[model samples]
Target: MQYQLRVSGNLYKELQQHLFPGDGKEAVAVALCGRYERDGISILLVHELMLIPHKECYRAEDVVCWKTETILPFLEKASKKDMAILKIHSHPGGFPAFSDVDDESDKDLFSSVFGWCESDSVHGSAVMLPEGRIFGRVITPKLESFPFDKVSVAGDEIKVWEHNTSSYSPDDFAVRTAQAFGEGTYSKLRRLKVGVVGCSGTGSPTIEQLKRLGIGELVLIDPDEVEHKNLNRILNTTREDANLRRLKTEVLSSHIRETGLGTKVVAYPFNLYDSPEALQELITCDIIFGCVDSVDGRHLISQLTNFYLIPYFDQGVKLDADGKGGIDKVSGTVHFIQPGSSSLLSRGQYTRQILFDECLRRQDPVEYSKRLKAGYVHNADVDRPAVISINMQISSMAINEFLNRLHSFKNEPARNYAQVSMDYSDGSICNVAEDDLPVDDYQVMWAGRGDLSTFLRMIELSAVKV
Candidate 1:
């Protein structure tokens, strides 16, 4: 089976710091991870990482040898969760390949660790060059091995190293899109597997644009049914459908299939974070458009994008009311979250406190209600007014941003606008206010941080069994 390893930027940064401390000596890094299965391929997501002190090593300058005391504990911890283990060490000599010492080490280590833990879970070893490029491989208990097809690190910018494939030609249908962004852009769109979370105001419109642009496949996630009030903003929704309480995803799924555009659609009428089975489908997507409203929902997408090494575009709309029944503040934000770049958290779009409050509400309505009544916590707007026009405007901008990313059609660098915020009342849009990508040496923080050490507090109880 083919394998791919994803490391979160935080862990990657940790690895770099530990292995290349200014002291200038090789170090050891170990990560305990779980598997994401897609089409029989196992994608390892490193959840927790630890740096073993080099003093635990008993080798000379050019070689690395870890003490059994340090190695046994990591293996035992990994075996407890049936998780895979990745052993990594740096190569200051600029060799990306495993050295003879590494081969001898793995032959002895991989062979004994499994016996010690009685684990059939896959274990692998990797070599990281001084420049931070990683070449990883999966090893069998029998000592057989295969190189990892690619490695991904997710942070403010997503970095990927996939096996090469020939470029494709755009079809006749993409003529207009090709004219606008060059033919090369169309090829990128066709090979993409995009995910749209939430099929309401913003999500529906975002989906509408992606389909017409000749995207190859889509995964739609929404746990809502059409309501009478939603008809005004949700595209492709009808009166009859609203009256029947038809699932929003089903409505969109039917439309895409009817177009016969060869765009595959998988609709899940469930919250993305609450459905592990559905989350699996998302691992295959190249990009995700987060169009949900809740802070909790956004939090999940923000983390998922990093772990899966998938770029994400998250758009949100907010309206503030003036007690006097007049227009007050109308604003929305379109943030293009690339892996290995500055993240939403770093941007301050949503805070840890907001996520905490939202989770409390979802888990316990009574306590949340009591807290709200006592003014112990602030609540988000439950019935914010929404208009199709503004939704369309923001959605269009987000889609345009997506195009800009793949084609860089604009004269200025795309990074210039890491985030674009608009004030509808003021009729102004600008991306300069927000901080751009950070230059931290650890840009790879969660570049590929996959499944959490434990199911996220809110997601654990909610993940529906397949």
Candidate 2:
């Protein structure tokens, strides 16, 4: 099984501060983690962090020891919640690999942790360098350790570190892209597994760009089939696809395979709300691009990404045409959501009332229609105008947002552009920072609660186990 660890950028910053503290000695900390294990993939999502006080440990440049009792409370909590434990420490001297001393310390510490927790789950030990880059390993129940295959930090900028950096020789189609972003960034793209929700309009173009840019793997989720109306906006779709009523995911997956770029694709022809298996597949993605139009779909993806500590990019387009045939408004928005920080809900992308109404409309359409007629719910069924040019523009912006987060080529920091708004009618654009957005207490309460008994804490999902 491939083992991985994910930490929110906010928590990673906290760990860095406590671990470094401008000292020339090592320091220790403990992290309580929620886990997701399926299909030979195991991930640890850090839920909470506890820093051992410097005064409580004997510190040196290469070695630091703390009392085992300091972590008993956290261990008890982990046992109660079925969570895993991760022991993290700092290397003040910029050591790249785990030392022999670290191996000995981890063996002893995890042995006690496995015994105390009394569960058949894996634990981890990590080391952070002065530059805030982290690497770690997972320890099996037998106390045998294997290096983490991947370690990712979900923040304003998506940062990922892999145990092995596989060599890449770009094909003819990707040679130009490699030159534009540098070979290192291109190599990173080849290692990333991205998920795209929704396959029409924005999602099609988003998937096209990702595959051409050499994404290693893609998980495509959408329940709809190709209708004639989608031919105008969806890329690579033909009249035959529309007539055949082909699944959007299937069409996209086939196109990617035909490109011969070696980008693996897994298509799920099912709605995100009703499929627990799709949710499990989505969590395996390093980054998510949410191109769905429904408020409920966006809301669900926001919750799932936060739970798994994955960075998310959500984009939508709005076209308002005056009944007289004149264009009144044309606009689009792309929101970049970081785990443990401001979310789409907190950013006012949708209100709780709207989310509730949408969910009702999906679960009980007859009741929703009756409520709509009674003026108890908003009428959200109006068909909006869509143009390929507008969709492509917004899709490019969203993909560029993802690229900037990976390579950081923008003049301003990624954190400053939590939301990007493009007004095509006005010919203007705007960016909003994360600090400017409001926070929702409810979203905060659920952040990093991975693999809960109920998926996303939604009762309906509990019935369908992954």
Candidate 3:
């Protein structure tokens, strides 16, 4: 794949910081996000990625960029068929020429790019000059730099260089991201199966976003419907959608398929603790997200994820409404539950009491049946009607958790707290994985038939000397 990257406004500032030495980076750099939008697409870069042993510097020096250390690990994680198109850099001076040192570096750099990034494909690199001039170069398998001086960057994507001689131009950022991802990260996820538990509130948006991210198979769990109250949070559902008695999973499945997302949605109306059925879906998903209402559900899902070796991202929101119901205090939490690496639970986020209580409540028939009748067992989870903004926030927050656990693009974004809150009314952000954990003896009692001696005696008595 020929790689191109579009420049976003946010990205422009980041590159300048790394090259020009702003307050941004005292250290390393990184490529944070790869996304698409109507304006164009590009990768989001931030100053946080710099975790190398070398001292970070803004001026030209003997020390290599910390961002450079990040590449090998990324490539090592990728397969041979995938390659990076270019190492986007900046020259604050607006100097068009590659410094003599840059020329020497290009040969060595492109050699590595060909051995890795350009394997069975073509790739390029680019520089953004401080004066706003941009340059790109094509690389051969042998590490020769064919400076495409004729190239131009029109936003995030690059218009093809028309000159036989080196030239330059600005290209579209979105187009470049698409091409880069096609040859690299996105293609690797083509066969993945993702599971979303609870398709209301955050879950609804999460399902939509996952499908958009190109997951091939999704197991959507929920059993609720469209209620006038829920209109506040669920995505795609309108007032017109309310009268139809829409099932959350079924509706979300329809939305995903109708959009040509190419993702297969398996609608599970059953609750997450429903044993055999829940286990089946858990075994099938590559990743799982918890967007359910109950603490019991999270613990159940967390346990399943560990046993199955599937990564799980769980998110929740707590609000303290004021008397007017207009505004008050709110808290949102996102956690990455890895199979074994001292999870959020280890940090005191959730405890055994919360998990067991939830389990008992769900296991009880009266409560389960009641939620079922109210459609709580089925559709979205909210004490009251929900709104769109909160739902999307939860979904995005969950997705963000997923990325933080999976990618090391930047030093983790700062947390206002491990908890997120807009509580002038009062709020806190917390990283509570260390609170309390479940010592689940999910083990079944071995109540096998008592010793057979008594049965033999009874049999003999009944035999009547036979």
Candidate 4:
């Protein structure tokens, strides 16, 4: 099985500060992680970090040794919760590979950790360089060490360090793309597994752009089937598909495969709310695009991203027209969400009442309709006008936002443009900085609580088994 370690941007900054305190000697820290294992992929999501003080360890430029008792408390805690442990240390000299000394130390440490935890689960150790690039190995129950497939830091800028580098030569189709965004950026795209949670409107165009840009893998999630009304917006859909009631994910997956691009696609013909299997696959993605219009769907995705330490790009389009053929408003928004930061809720995208109503409508539509008729719930079932041009525009903007996060070609830092708003009616565009957004206290409390018994820590999901 392949192994990966995921760390939130904020936590990585903390680790960096303690690991490299301007000292020539090595420093060490320990992380208690939540585990996710499925489909031959195992991931460790760091939940807590414990940095050993310099005074507690014997330090040298090449090696550092600390008392095993220093981590006893963490070991006990992890054992109680059946969590995994990862020990990380700094390599101040920029050593590219783990030394023999590190191997022996890991062996001794993980051996004790396994025995104390009294489980066959895996534990790991890693080394971080001065430049913030990390590489690590996983230690098995048998005390055998295997290099980790990759170590990813999910922050304002997504960073991934792979143990083995696969050589990729851009084909003629991608030559223009490589020239526009350096070959390095193109290569990064080929290694990313991106998830698009909707399959129509914005989601269709977003998936098309990602595939053309040579995204390595695409995970498509949507429960709806092709319908006559959506034919105008969903890309590559035909009348025959609507007649056959083909699933949106199936249609998109087929279209991507027909392009002859090397990108792999996995389609889930189910919604994220009720399908534990869909959630299992979604959590494996490196990045997620929220193309759904429902407030509850967006809220759930935001929560999932924070828990799994994945970067999220959420897009929405709004068009209001008077019955008398006058246009009232035309606007759209694209929000760049980093793990452990302000979310769509804190940005006023939706309030608690709206989320509750959406949930009620989804779970008990008959009751919701009755409540609406009784004047207890707002009427949210109106069908809004959807234009292909508007959907494409917003989709392109969201795709560009993802590219900016990867290559950072923008004039200002990405943190300055947390949200981009466009108003076609007023012919105006605006950007909001992360500092301007209110802090999401709820997101902060739930971040990195990965792979819980109940999905996303919701009571409704406890009954669904993957």
Clashing pairs in 4: none
- Candidate 1, residues 1-466, lDDT tens digits: the string is 6688877655677888887765556778888776665466777777677788877775454677776566566678677756777888887778757778888888887777777666555777887777887887888767788888767664333355554434556667778888898766776677677999989999999998999998889999999999999999998889999999999999999999998777889999998766776777777677889998998888788766765667789999988778677658889989877655676776777777887788889878899889889987778747787889989999999998888767676777666767888998898998842244453223245445455545432345344331
Tens-digit per-residue lDDT, 1-466, candidate 4: 9999999887898999999999789999999887887889888888888999999999999999999898888999889887889999999999989999998999899889998998687988999999999999889999998888988988777888787778577899999888988898888899999999999999999999999999999999999999999999999999999999999999999999999899999999888887888888889999999999899899989988998888999999999988877768999999998877799999999898989898999999999999988988877777889999999999999998889888889999888878999999999989999889987987777677677777677887886452
Give the TM-scores of the predictions, in the order they appear: 0.74, 0.98, 0.49, 0.96
Q: After superposition, how far is residue 290 of candidate 1 from its true place, in Å?
A: 1.3
Which ten-residue region of model 4 has the weakest summed lDDT?
A: 457-466
Best by lDDT: 2
**Shift of residue 439 alpha carbon in model 3, Å:** 12
**Best of the two (1, 2) by TM-score:** 2
Write down the worst ten-residue block by lDDT for model 1: 433-442
Instruction: Judge candidate 4 against the unseen true structure and give its global Cα lDDT, from 0 to 1.
Output: 0.90
TM-score for candidate 3, please give it. 0.49
What's the distance in Å from true for residue 385, model 4?
A: 1.0
lDDT of 2 by residue, 21-44 (tens): 887899999999989888899999
Give candidate 3's root-mean-square deviation (CA, Å): 17.0
Scored by TM-score, the top model is: 2
- The CA lDDT at 98 in model 3 is 63
lDDT of 1: 0.76
